[model samples]
Target chain A: MIYKSLLPIIITLLITMAMLNYLISHVGNEEVKALEVENEYLLTINVFKQLNNTVPKIFQAKACLLISNPINYTCNVIASNITGIIMNALGIISNESSGVVRYEVVDYVIYGINNETIYYVTIKALTPMGDTTGIVGYTYPFNLCYYSQFIKELMNTLNANFTIDVENITVVQSSLGNEIINRVKSLIGTSSINITINIYYVGVFRMINRSINRTTYLGQVSYTARISPNNVHTCNEITTLAGAFYVTAVVNRYVNNTYYFSINGAININSMVINDKTR
Target chain B: MVVVDSLVFPDLVITMILIIIILLLIVYVTNQLIELSMIDYKASMGTYLFLKCQLGNFTIHLNHVIITNGTSSSNYLLICPQLVVNGSQIGAKVYTAYVKW
Candidate 1:
């Protein structure tokens, strides 16, 4: 009968439907895998965007201090501080730092190269695939030479060059100005707290070796500059580059898809190298 | 012979043709499904490529905005810290982004 013929057709239809379902499922799985890889890139870029400039350089400052002089803050202390920062930023990174990209922070390594430090952080995603990295930045090579030495040498030069005391310090004579000093000047706002020293490497050549190899005569290294107590915005009585600490505030605001990151930091007085015998 | 041709044989022929059509439809639909998947893959990849370009710009802008000052760019700004005696430091400062970061 006709019913007997319809049975064969029904069986064929069921088999075809099964095959199509399997094909769709397989293709979907492949697409999902590809999507995961894209997500990794998104997550990396997001983390990089979040870290910005000031954050890395601050850690580098600590690294510069630690490698240059270990007595001020223990490695453990700095490590804990780094952990605290990552933890504090967890909510921010998950919710706010990344607009749409998502990831987790696992750990960070304070890597030093060419007497400079950059942060290499491991960011984890909730994907089947694992962790990845985004970099932070560096302090200047000149700063690795130490702020005390820089200020002291400049002070000596200033003393020898002109008859101006700390009070009358203004407009470094264009003759006295060099590439390095001007480079330092532009990083900080006028009458700002914290000193930011940024040095872009020509070749991050992975070629590095650190030594305390510095030689300069520092006369009267000890000088005092006032620091405002309540949330140091300005170094009111700071002249002659003394007592000013490294404190950078990141006004990183994303408005209308325009990202803004600016740093206002201090030139850490604790890393002072006064005596010729010490440095 | 005429009865067989008119009823069972003709019916068998039509049924076979319908089965063939259904099988062809399945093949066409499967190919379309695959093509759709590929389009989605291409779109996602394109988005990531755009993001990668933005990252490059971000790197450039970060280097310029931090050390140097006073200039603008709608494209790649050179990255190097220097002291320019002539006028403004010889580099781009303001990076006018082409895409949302």
Candidate 2:
């Protein structure tokens, strides 16, 4: 009589368990797709946040170079190299999406009386659907003032103490020019391997009566600085020509074989006259 | 005959109705428990995916608990045991912590 009375309770318990299992399985199946969507959204947000934290730091460090010498070719080098290292680090951080998405350089815009070059640059990591995760923009300003100062120093050194003779000029070009270039490189902080500094003078010198013409000046003396850590061997030359009697100096700089910066220095070169007649 | 019909029949009918009510209550409670588990599983999985991406290499442990009125509570470990081999987690730097909730 007891067994018969408990039979209904036992049967009911078994049926309830079966129904619970079915319900759990059904819920699990329905949520799989929703879970996947949520997971992707969360991952994207995580990546974007990480990028926001890091990209600015890298940009700030590299952009600081521009503050010192805006037209320093090493600025470009350091920016790209550091950015590449950071990108590689980020790739290893998360294996979800690895590699550079896209980067754009807004051709160096020469602006202001100082002739500062402004690079409006932007880098982004995005998919084809325009879903951007990581992005950075920088309006990098570089003034040619630093380079102009060096040129002024070079001109002063050449005119003040050095005699206008082949031997003297050769010594001045090799020794004094090398010293200046080395100092500039050190000041710009591009202490990388495989740097080549080429300095030479260009123009016509009518050596009449062992005296330089009154209208004579170093037509175009160039400082071709090639500083490459990655062996790209790009030549950046700042060619400056002093005007008649040093009334003015016109400066033109070619970076990566493209003329980008120009400036005019207000200085008197009247003292550079070499009159062998006086000797 | 009058006493048998009034008292015994009424008792039998009441007992059947009580049994039906108990079964329905059981089904309702079971459904609610399963729904809670479903929510827990979804949240845990989402957390696991997020940590995996943000933290690089990490481990996750999710402990699920279920209790019923007449039975003892049961504990379940949702994720399987993942062995850390050769002290190398995909050759990545151990960023923060190994395992999280």
Query: Which candidate number would show the highest TM-score if scored against the true structure?
Result: 2
Q: What is the TM-score (0 to 1) of candidate 1?
A: 0.35
Q: For each of the candidates, what fraction of the native contacts does it recover?
A: 0.00, 0.08
Q: Give me the overall lDDT of model 2.
A: 0.37
The Cα local distance difference test for each model comes to: 0.37, 0.37
Residue-wise C-alpha lDDT for candidate 2, range A6-62, written one tens digit per residue: 458757776877777677677666665455444344334444454444544454444
Could you tell me the lDDT of residue B16 within candidate 1?
A: 76
DockQ of each: 0.02, 0.07
lDDT of 1 by residue, A137-205 (tens): 333332222333333444343233221112111221221233223333432213222333322111001
